[model samples]
Target: MLMDAFVDILRTIIWPLAIVWVSYIFRNELRGLLNRLSLFKYKDLEAKFEKELLEVEKEAKEAEKLLDRSLPHIADNEQEKIEQLLRIAGISPRAAIMEAWREVECALNDVAKQEGIRVKGLVGNSLSADKLAQIRGIPRENTDIYTRLKYLRNQAAHVPDYVIEEREARRYVQLAIHLAGVFRLKPNE
Candidate 1:
């Protein structure tokens, strides 16, 4: 039984890792060769596009930072105070929070149509490493944040009577801040 189990793991995990390692070793050479191909003669244009793409990414990152700083991780207790923060920050606090969580989910889609890093879940599902990376210029290493927020969002939505308590809200704020930092976003000024 042990030998069979070992063989199964070798087939599923070890083989895949070996393939990826080989591909990574040749990644740079592949890029250079692709540039030399007749169909890819416009490599110079590609380089220029990369630069412009990077600039747009930077601008988006700035917007994210502005929003993160303006919105408190620990939103106040009063509805009026929350509204005031939203107004001052030029955002809808509830909407922004919900949307941010959704965005993280969509990042795993295969249809992003951009070349950048991506995070994969345990099932090998893809997430957009680009939107977050372009905005924050950081990579996602751990896969915990996605699962945790997803659980919370589901719980809140599924149970009509379940209200997010103050304690839960505070944790969300802290989680967002920690995630922002993971993506290399500095705490707002």
Candidate 2:
């Protein structure tokens, strides 16, 4: 058995060596053939790379449009409301809190829309704030902020007598602004 195995190994080695000898004997022809094959491979690789690059460029353009769409557009009236809320944050903390949450929701909806998340449907939107955070590849800390903002919004909207402090409301607004920035969508002041 050992002799047979040795013979098999020698046979394999001999075939390779014979191929090498043949190649050496026809070195010029082999070289030309190899050069042609390499050139073909290079051309194919280059074409594939160019195709991939075009795809990347197309995706980049689409991404730019998506980012533009994600930007929150504060209408003149909405900006006025924000200014009013900021001015009276102390006097009407609840209203300011509600407004801040609403702004966050608005930003979330805009981002969701840009992400192609349908809002109205039987399935509802998969790109809620949580899913958006994941899709945007946000850090855990920032995702936590998103979760907190959503919680606060839910509380202010659905929960009864959810009195939000001015400080907390301000923080929510800051988080909303941060979320907007995550998608390269700076809210127009």
lDDT per model, in order? 0.44, 0.55
After the best TM-score superposition of candidate 1, give how far the Cα of residue 26 lies from its true spot, in angstroms: 63
TM-score for candidate 2, please give it: 0.43
**Model 1, span 27-51: residue lDDT tens:** 9988776655633434443344334
TM-score to true structure, per model: 0.30, 0.43
lDDT of 2 by residue, 1-189 (tens): 999999999998998999999999999999888766665554454354344334433443444444423445656875676667676566765566566655556666776776787775222122365576566654334444545555555555663434555655554454455454554343331
Best by lDDT: 2
Candidate 1 residue pairs in clash (backbone atoms < 3 Å): 107-127, 107-128, 108-126, 108-127
lDDT of 1 at 125: 26
lDDT, candidate 1, residue 48? 40
Off by over 4 Å in 1: 1-141, 184-189
* Candidate 2 deviant stretches above 4 angstroms: 1-82, 121-127, 154-163, 183-189
- In each prediction, how many residue pairs overlap at the backbone (N, C-alpha, C within less than 3 A)? 4, 0
